[model samples]
Target: MRRKVYTKDQILKAAYEVVENEGFSGFTARNIAKKMGISTQPIYLEFKNMSDLKNALLDEICNHLYYDIFPEVRTGDTIIDLGLSYVYFAKEQSNLYNALYVQEYGGGKKMHDFSYNYFHQLIVKHPKYSKLSENKINALHVGTWIVVTGIATLMSSGIIEPTQDEIVHLIDRTINTVLQEDDTSVLDSL
Candidate 1:
């Protein structure tokens, strides 16, 4: 008997549903197959193994993370708005955000590089940053990422239950600190 073929996208859609409903803990080949309404063998036929399917899911997640959030980073806009949007995206897609960054997965390359490169590029685009050293820009990027990630984890773990207003204010402080520091420098040096 010929094996039935499933499209790669079909498997990804099913996998996303599995992630949404069951999370990483509850998803498995059986679950996906049930969701797809087909035998698991078709998944095996389409993908070499569960890892292949998962890597594809990660790719889609990466795309969603980048595409959905990139508009805020682009537009040559103010950095403060960009920082706030980051938190908003994290809050809105908490599940997908945790899945992309918090979950353990096989392909280390995609896990580490795909999302980060865009983040690095975004930091380089900051308007006030052109006058700063590369090290300073890199530090700002890393620090901003740390702030958002820490807040997301804290919110998810229930460690720091910040109101939405508090989160907005905190993000505003982080972004405002950059210019405040720049503006507060010794004016006599100019």
Candidate 2:
């Protein structure tokens, strides 16, 4: 009998599918092998261990978010567009969202940091935020992050099913409230 051979990319693709369909809990070498219709030996041969495979998977997820998910949303407002993209991701890719945010999988920190920094830069460069000081912008970004993440979490968890208008309205209201707050002291504290 001939031994079946799988490349590293092939194994990672199988792992990605497993994670996408089954979330992180179903992310195992055995599952990947099963998905690929091969023995675990091919997976082991392609990677050092599960941890290495996980890191690679994380990179794939991040790339998918950056290239595939985030770029698809364009609302003419960078911050709102970002929020919408995140919400779309949560709604469309519930399993991946839960694995990254809800379950706090191995890639959670990397994803969080990437999202935070990306949104922060958008806020800083936005003309609507130009009148705001650095501290104020930072505060606004934090507030936006909380609101967006909260909405995404709720939707992903099946706690609420808000329409696109409702989601946009909620995000707009939160941003407006942050921008309109008269208490500069609170903004400066951050």
Candidate 3:
């Protein structure tokens, strides 16, 4: 019998499946090998080490979020749509969401940077937010991100099952509160 060789991409896909199904805790070379029905030698041969494989997996997860998850939301408003996509991802891919957000797994900064930059771009382009200073826009993004993340965490853990309408209401209220606070801060400063 001849030995089967796995490409890096194949190994990465197996690793992703392991994490998606079993969360980060199951992200081991042995587990990946088991999933692929091969020995761990293939994984070690394709990647330098588990850390390297995990970093690659993080990129894979980010790509999945960017392509598979984020693009599915289209509510005519980019910012709100992003929030909805996040919540939807949490609900649909709870294990992946927890691995990235709750467990960190070296993905927290990547997710934060991606979300903040994306939100900033949308806010800068929005008619309502375009006039706001960059500082104010950043504040608004952070504030809204906190609320959205909290809701997503709760939803992913099955602690709270809010309807889409409820999520929209909560997100809208958070955005409004942030803007209102910024306005009041300006008034107080005046």
lDDT values, one for every candidate: 0.65, 0.80, 0.80
Taking all chains together, each candidate's TM-score versus the true structure is: 0.72, 0.83, 0.85
Tens-place lDDT digits, model 1, residues 1-190:
9855788899889989888665676568899999989988878888899887887788787777677765563334444445556556656666665666677743245755764576556656665555665545545555565677788777766577776567666655665564455533332132
Error of 3 at 187 (Å): 17
Alpha-carbon RMSD to native, per candidate: 6.0, 2.8, 3.6
Candidate 3 deviation (Cα RMSD):
3.6
Name the TM-score of candidate 1.
Answer: 0.72
lDDT of 3 by residue, 1-190 (tens): 9978799999999988988888788989999999999999989998999999988888777777777777565666667788999988888888888877778453678777877777887778779778887666776777667778899989988899898888888888877776777444532331
Q: What C-alpha lDDT does candidate 1 achieve relative to the native structure? A: 0.65
As for candidate 2, its clashing pairs are none
Candidate 2 ranges beyond 4 A from true positions: 1-3, 130-134, 181-190
Which of the two, 1 or 3, has more lDDT? Answer: 3
Question: Which pairs of residues collide in candidate 3?
Answer: none
User: What is candidate 2's TM-score against the reference?
Assistant: 0.83
Model 1, position 165, has a per-residue lDDT of 65
